[model samples]
Target chain A: MNTRYIFGIIITVVLLSVNQAFIQYWLAQKKHDANTINIAGKQRMLSQRINAEFYRLEKESASPHLLKKLVAEWKTSHFKLQSKDKSNKLVPITNSEIRLALKELNPNIEFIESQLNNIGKASLNLSLINQNQNSFLPKMDKIVKSLEKISDKKLQFIIKTEFFLFFMSLIILILEVVFIYIPIEKSLNLANAEISKKNEDLKQALTSIGKKNRELEQITYITSHDLQEPVRTINSLVNIFKIKYARDFDEEGIKMLRYLDTATVRMRDLIKDLLDYSIIGKKREKTKIDCAEILEIISKDLALKINETKAKITWGRLPKILGIEAEIRLLFQNLISNALKFQMKGHQPKIDIAAIEKKDFWLFTVSDNGIGIESKNVEKIFSIFHRIHSKDKFEGTGIGLAHCAKVVDIHGGAIWVESELGKGCTFFFTIKKDQNKIVGYEQQTELYITS
Target chain B: MNNKLNSILLVDDDEATNFIHQFVIQDHGACKHIVTKLDGQEAFDYLTTPNESGLPSPDIIFVDINMPKLDGWGFLEKYESEFGSNSSKIIVMLTTSLNKYDKERAESMNVISEFRNKPLSPEILDEIVEKYFTNKHMVQ
Candidate 1:
């Protein structure tokens, strides 16, 4: 719970407990007050009975022992009215009216007791005894009435306090419901609604992005495929025209035709490269690709080139990676061909390929003794159509490295080059071990974007 | 070099491509009679119908892979069901698609003689004719 809620609960519990304790104390005091009132009322009856017994001794010959017993009982009852308990110690009386009534009765009770002490003696004063008894009875009666009034007042106070405590507890409960509980519930509901709305929005955005990606892929494939036919036709017609009408064309016209043929050929290559680039990641299947075997195939394919250049291509033992075989083959083809193509003049190309196992992926390096790239242009080489050298020097559609980058990216890896001018270059790329877990382009895009 | 074919059929969706192939085949002296169709559907109809001369089917059929109506794969399936490998016609799968699956599929089919890329050249045409028709010409 939050700090505020915890504090609220603690305070509510403390207040209710304190109120309950006060009610309990007051109820115990109510019982003590009832006992004090009962003793005070009994003192009044004792005083009257003692006076009547004294009158019987004086006129109708009552027993002195009964009178003495009545006197003793009267004293004990009177003491108990003001005392704390049977110990007969005077309690601190809080009600001044009952205290004054008991104080006035004390002297009359003492005088009657003194007259009764000489009951069987000749020194007994009957008249004095009658007078003191008469005064003590009314005084004790006044004390009894005052005690009842105080008890009644105390009982009423206890009842009123109990009702107040109940009302306050109800108010606290209502306040907590209105201020704390209801608002917490409402905010919880609002937060839930907002979260669901955001989820819905994200879902819609993802579907739309998927749809747009599919549409763009279709457009790219269709446009490149359809454009190839016209370019091929142009190339073929130009060849036919040169053969059929060579006598009519001058030197300049022939040269112009040659330029047209070169342009058409370049356009065709660019379209083919674009189509190839767009087709990457279209098929999302991962299988065990033996890099060593793929290297063997590439070696066989480039055997003539290797012989012609007398280039020595060597590789360490390679590992099998989980990836699309075609994509991985294309990646290796581009990197190795690039290494061979950028060789220095009169220098035998020395290519070394090796794979190092990392924590989560295999890092492969293709190092070549070739005319390496400049440091500034290394990053730009992976972009589509971004060529560092002029078309006259390097013959390429400039899509090879871009294709390599896309393949590595879709396999959940990274590709980069470390090179210097006029020296050898090393192209490093990684293939994730868990390539089968890669779902598709959408997930791959999210992965790279986050990384 | 007496390895010229009697006839050749070009099945493709693009009219320009068909024209270029026709021009190239004629210029190479590979065939005297050349026939072209827009898609696999027209090629199927032509192969099934009886001609006026009642000559046998063309010696070679160059079929493009990607087409609007009834693609090369569809035509191949229909042709195998209809002819059942008894026919002597040579079928070449010709297309611009560099997809490896298409080449593999063509390689797996017994009816297909060869799979070649588009923009057929004179050198490639000569090689095909030499490889398949030269021995036949000697036997004849």
Candidate 2:
């Protein structure tokens, strides 16, 4: 995977973890808050009930039956308070489980209620205790005192449960902030670092390209202006020799003169080709290109050679792409001409063309059943002026493949040849899909200028 | 039309180029004397030799721009400052380059009569012969 994608994934995971932690912390806080409110509310209700019971006791002192009923009511209320509180009090660990445990205390609450009823029955025998008023008062006070004990116990339980919940919630919040949120920040910083490194690499590449551009400019100037002088000298000398020495020359000298003239013409053609190679595709431009049309154009351009060699060219499906059209055409022209040039002795010249699409890229193959190259010279073929065959054997500038390589490189692609001697040769190259939808195919780069 | 201009000088580094030019001058059958040098040094030395009698100094010197040791530009430098301006010789820049820089350098020297590209043709020789050898009549 690309480094950027990896960094993106890490940042995403960190953010998700942070989000999950925040949600969990919020839920924990909500649970703790609800429990505290429930506990406090339960305590307040029990306190209010006890206050009412005490006031009622002070008002009704003469009626034993009424006093007995009031005592029974207070006992029942106290038991209910203890039972409800045991269930609802701040369950620090698990409030729902505590609620279930409080159900188990129901029977205990009922037993306490029974004890209250008995207390009511005993209070009705106040005639025996009224002989000592203080004794009867103390008797009623004991019944009330038992109710207060239960209420106080429930209040203390709720206070402890609520305190524990608050502490646990604080711990969960701190853990979430430190472990989840902090790592997210760190991941983002790492992504920033990766981006910065890529940026620096890009800057260095551009600087190097700038230096290369200057060198290329100098080479172009020297080649166009300096090397040309010698060829012109040779041309003018040829003209002079023909004018001055034609009368003295024999048939051999005349033949030599023709060879000299032909050689000079060939040199001129080679120099022009080299100049085109370096100059074309230097400033890469994107444009819509139809491969079939470009091929037709090249065929038309090389019609004379094709007719001379009686070469048969066949093309497979060629998908149109966005590229520099002229350079692409030159690439095809060179490869096709090379195929035509290196033909088997007596076999009919035949070339096979094929292409396939692979995920936003196109692979093109130009194969010929001509003279195949050795494996060792595969890499050497693309180098400037490198020729497997000598000039005497074949007529070539030895720059066609070099020009094609340059053109493919400008498209952010690569061109390579696979071949075995006497078998055949196939040229492969890849062209990327240009999204900007431009159709610029200008070809005027000057890559080579020979003497 | 007989004038005091009877001699001509040719300066170039390449012996073959000088030989060809000398052949062309002889073929044209004009100037009484044609002094050839391998570089600008010999040409400058021959020019600065003080002459008491006004036997015409090389009436015109054709200097090739590219040379070893003393180039045409260097010869021009000595010709002006070391030798006085009132001399009889006229200088012409002969080079293989038609580059603007070479032309500009020649013009700035102030000693040059004209700039010409090399592999001098019969036409160029004729022009030179007519310009300096006033005594020579046109070939019929």
The positional error of residue A317 in candidate 1, measured at the CA in angstroms, is 4.5
State which docking tier applies to candidate 2. incorrect
- The alpha-carbon deviation from the true structure for residue A375 of candidate 1, after best TM-score superposition, in angstroms, is 5.3
Cα lDDT, model 2, residue A60: 71
Each model's TM-score, in the order given?
0.60, 0.45
| Chain A TM-score from candidate 2 | 0.52
Candidate 1 regions exceeding 4 Å error are A1-189, A304-317, A343-352, A368-378, A418-425, A442-451, B7-15, B33-94, B97-116
lDDT of 2 by residue, B1-140 (tens): 23334677889876666666666665565555788888878887777666686533776788987778888778888888876554556787887564566777777766787788876666986676568554443432
DockQ for every prediction shown: 0.26, 0.07
Off by over 4 Å in 2: A1-169, A172-198, A217-221, A234-273, A282-297, A300-308, A316-326, A355-362, A389-397, A432-451, B1-140
Tell me the tens digit of each residue's lDDT in model 2 across A1-451.
Answer: 2454455557556655765665576556556445544443443344334334434544574334554454455445334433535454333323344334434434533443443355435443333222323332333344334434444555576567556655665665556557666677688889899999999999899878866775775587568556555775676667668867987999999999989988887876776676666566654566889999998888899899788878899997899988878888889989998998898656777888889998867899999989899999999999988888988777787888988988887776779999999988999998877544323332444333221
**What's the distance in Å from true for residue A347, model 2?**
2.5
User: For model 2, what is the error of residue A123's alpha carbon versus the real structure, in angstroms, after optimal superposition?
Assistant: 36
Residue B72 lDDT in model 2? 79
What fraction of correct interface contacts does each candidate retain?
0.35, 0.04
